[model samples]
Target: MTPYDAAHSQGSNVLTDGFGRTVTYLRVSVTDRCDLRCVYCMSEHMTFLPKAEVLTLEELDRIASAFVGLGVKKLRITGGEPLVRKNVMGFIEGLSRHLRSGALQELTLTTNGTQLEQFARPLAEAGVRRINVSLDTLKPELFRRLTRGGEIARVLAGIDAAQAAGLKVKINAVALKDDNAAELPELIRWAHGRGLAVTLIETMPMGEIDADRTDQYLSLSALRAELESFWTLRELPLTTGGPARYVEVAETGGQLGFITPLSHNFCEACNRVRLTCTGTLHTCLGREDAADLRAVLRGGGSASDLVDAIRMAVDTKPKGHDFHIERTLPPAVARHMSTTGG
Candidate 1:
């Protein structure tokens, strides 16, 4: 039997998927355009969506308000790089108003750390409580190779600014075999020194970029084994709303997290859906099951109509997804990680 609850229909605005997962977290991609050309995300000289096709801040505010009304407690602003979008601070401040009004419980952001130094204080003032920055390699030369001209110093400066601004910061590292795999211990130590947690994620096969993904498929098991060889890991209580498995590093008295989307499946506990900048509701990351929320928004739909559309999208959520590297590419694998708000 599928793990669906048919009794709760579209009439009510509760966002529960087929697997009995109560969806409360909404990741909103503000823009698909990014400044950096990471090896695993997109190719150099990429084409971005036209400005007219992107949703205005007002439209995003309305859509976000509707989701909050349906019991969404948390909202994460994501992007190719959220800071790269124009007037992003204003957008964040608007979301902050929702938090202030008690309509939202948490407002956070996931950024590439390229532009955090300039926006950290303003962002925190805007009521963003937590921030997640993507940092794969600590070494400058390696960072340049991976991100294609990204400066390590700038990211480090951004992290410093985030910390100084009194915002809770975390580092997200994508584990790549024979690439940054060996640097895990050092990376952990560096992040721990700054009182920040590090979440090492096994790279998922999102899009076909200019990289040998087959060689880059490093398992979380390998990463954990490498860490265990030096430091002791103690299982910690799960408090974060995301899928990462947390462990306390006994050596540094710091926290370490593993998001093993590829090796270990966490779909059974999935409780989130993605809203692209184009206003499409993607029920699953590894599946192409999407509903055009933009169409509903632009078709003279009422607030109730928008809620009904979201309900219908949640109803079509898959029980689980089959995301693994295949000799032949999977249809869903065509999704660019950048565009998907990964």
Candidate 2:
């Protein structure tokens, strides 16, 4: 039987997976469409999910509530670009109500920061705690080239707006070996100068990237060695629930994070799962194992049915992701990151 605390028997729901890790974070992708088509994230011939197939705001809320009941505390709203969805601010407002009602501990979002100029203040007022913005390059030309026509100035404006709204901002940059490896120092200086933290991620072997995966993949250890050559890196605490290891950079007074999915895997402490825009529950990012919640939800299933589905998924959770083992191999994940809520 799946591990479960007797309902309200202990005054809280504790849902533990097969690995004995308690899940607290849930990532929900609101839309599969994005404004910027970064070369690493999507292919040129990608076809997004139809509007009719995407989950409605009401349906999303119901799903979130059920997860909360199953012991999910922190909720992150993601997307190809979450802010690109229509009336998404209203949906955030509704989720904020849930936070106020004590159904959720924290509400956060991950965006491209292009729409933050208009949505930042509203998001703050709606009870969002923080946001992670995808910014692969600092140079205007490089940013445009990387995102297939994104303006770095506009993203900077959006970041400024988010800061003004009192929203904690973090810059998530994917380190491409030949592309942005040398620019790491500059990116760190730029982010820390503005009181924002920057996280460097290794390029995952998912989707059709612009460059060769093996050639483009840069290990965090290698990046750290380069950073240490210039500045001293002091280890810091891991307060956040994510996989990124934290470090404080000397001289610059900035914090740097490395998400070494390929170098030093953090799957032994994995405590999160993903919900796709179409209501598919992905138990693991590196594996294609998923539970189709859309079928249950659309088939006139009750909240109890949804709970059962979640319980079964947790029971059968894989040992861990095989990203490290499949480094040089073909992509094991059939679905693109956009569809998987990355």
CA lDDT, every model vs. true structure = 0.84, 0.83
User: Residue 264 in model 2: shift from native, Å?
Assistant: 1.0
Clashes of each: 1, 0
lDDT of 2 by residue, 194-253 (tens): 999999998876665555578777888988998888799999986577888999988778
- What is the per-residue lDDT of model 1 for residues 223-284, given as tens digits with 9 covering 90 to 100? 79878888899999976788899999999989999998778888888888899898988888
Question: Which stretches of candidate 2 lie above 4 Å from their native place?
Answer: 1-12, 324-328
> Which pairs of residues collide in candidate 1?
3-18
Question: What TM-score goes with each of the models?
Answer: 0.94, 0.94
Best by lDDT: 1
**lDDT, candidate 1, at 270:** 86
In model 2, how large is the Cα lDDT of residue 238? 63
After superposing candidate 1, which stretches have Cα over 4 Å from the reference? 1-13
